[model samples]
Target: MALPDMDTSVGHSFGLEVDGIQIKQISEVSGLKMEQDVIELKQNTADGKYVIKKLPGRPKAGEVTFTRGLTSDNSFEKWIKDCHFGKMSDARKGGAVIVYDFEGNPIKRYKLTNAWAKSLEISTLKAGDTSVLTEKLVVTYEQMEAE
Candidate 1:
């Protein structure tokens, strides 16, 4: 039997059912290394602002990505957990998890009473400013077994 194509990278624009309405959501894995990994997501919107970016760098050793309210019973959050847990069977197994919020969503805001909130914010502005905010998700996966 042939092995499943280990997808090292993936990107997609999907709609997640939230509040009984389909909300646009994007997810992506930007960089990867022997040390750690990085993942990103954007949820809820029709405009381009609701998009995720594959950053150009990877995290160092001993790091984890996380999101707020994701532990709750939310569809979007569940999807993300699925991706990281096992659904994303291609991703590096046993790696760090990190979460980010661009517009400060109620769920995963970079704020805490005792925790230090920090993020590497990327400036979306450009010369043409014609870059349409498109929903996209990218991921780097590992080897897969054939069914």
Candidate 2:
């Protein structure tokens, strides 16, 4: 057996799901970052030579942004409000960003914990401009795991 082509996967084949909330449609999702900090230390030798060593620090959690066309659906907005005014014990939620194949089978999943909506914004409206109304949501999570 040989190694597979990782690039065979496409970026557009993905979706986001949150616990206890039904996600109808989302056109774009971005800022799913999984990263860590690097720590450097210098050790001084007796001969006046110093050696620099690098170590891994803590994991960093990033805010993910989702954009979708505005509709009658208000679940996302409600969730955002719940997180903003709800008690700390009942606000956080769990969610996942799942990547699927062309056949609709799941290929990868990024599980999130203690996730909550950080912000929500709606596109500016014009008098009679022929444009689609869109809403954007930013979500923050305490931790994430990829599988």
Candidate 3:
């Protein structure tokens, strides 16, 4: 048997989109995780022997976090407000995050169902230091699917 061909080109985590909006200059994206609960059962068998069995329980999706360089646009702020302060009917929008290869091709995509912003933060500014302003956003969703 022959091994499958490996891709050597470096893939970047920079390109990301949220609900069809292109987010540029993203520094970090994290928390694409899923976990399942494990149920352990203990039983006593014959001859005073003990046995343990494990079973799978419910599955959960973790929160997704995005960090990007701040820009002049207020889209992210508006989105956050919509989730927190806007009309209840307009909140909780579904979105997606696309990961691209170095050549600007989509390699993996994650769909977020009924997502809402849980928290938003801005980087601190200093008078003497030169640094780009950045925004950090954390979002929670009902479900996440890989496409």
Candidate 4:
């Protein structure tokens, strides 16, 4: 019998999309973390020893951060303004972060429910530097689902 060939392809981190928008020149994406609380209970037993019990609590998702070079478009800034100052109802929007493979195929996606921009930072400017302007966006979401 012949052995089946295994796929040795690796996924690349070249492109990502948020809310159906193509983000240009993404430097890095971090903060995909989840944590849970541990609860301990102590009880007295007939064996003259204390019995310790461990319980697991709810899990929490951490804030996700996306860093990229600043672009000419002001859509991100407008989105921030709409989230905080827009007169329209239901300003918050849910988005998805789709990661692509080396061949530009979709590998994984994280759906962010009720996501809003928690913070936005612009890179500092200098008089005699040749660095590209960059922006950092931190988003907070109610829940995240991996698909």
The alpha-carbon lDDT assigned to residue 37 of candidate 4 equals 76
Best by lDDT: 2
Scored by TM-score, the top model is 2
Pairing residues by index, what is the TM-score of model 2? 0.88
Candidate 3 lDDT over residue span 1-147, tens digit each: 222268543435445566667867778878987667899999988888999999998877568888888998776787788877755456577777777666566666788877778888999988997898899989887788888
CA-lDDT, candidates in order: 0.31, 0.84, 0.76, 0.71
lDDT of 4: 0.71
Off by over 4 Å in 3: 1-5, 8-11, 45-48, 86-88
By lDDT: ranked, best first: 2, 3, 4, 1
lDDT at residue 119 of model 1 (Cα atoms): 27
Runs in model 4 with CA error above 4 Å?
1-15, 86-90
**Residue 38, model 1, lDDT:** 57
Q: What is the Cα-based lDDT of residue 146 in candidate 1?
A: 15
The TM-scores of all predictions, comma-separated, are: 0.20, 0.88, 0.81, 0.77
lDDT over C-alpha atoms for residue 128 of model 1: 75
> Which lDDT tens digits does candidate 1 get at residues 1-147?
222356222223212222234333323333323343556665646664576755445534322222222123354334445555656432233222223223222221111111111222223656878644332223232321111
Candidate 2 vs candidate 3: the lDDT winner is 2
After TM-score superposition, the amount by which residue 41's alpha carbon in candidate 1 deviates from its true location, in angstroms, is 42
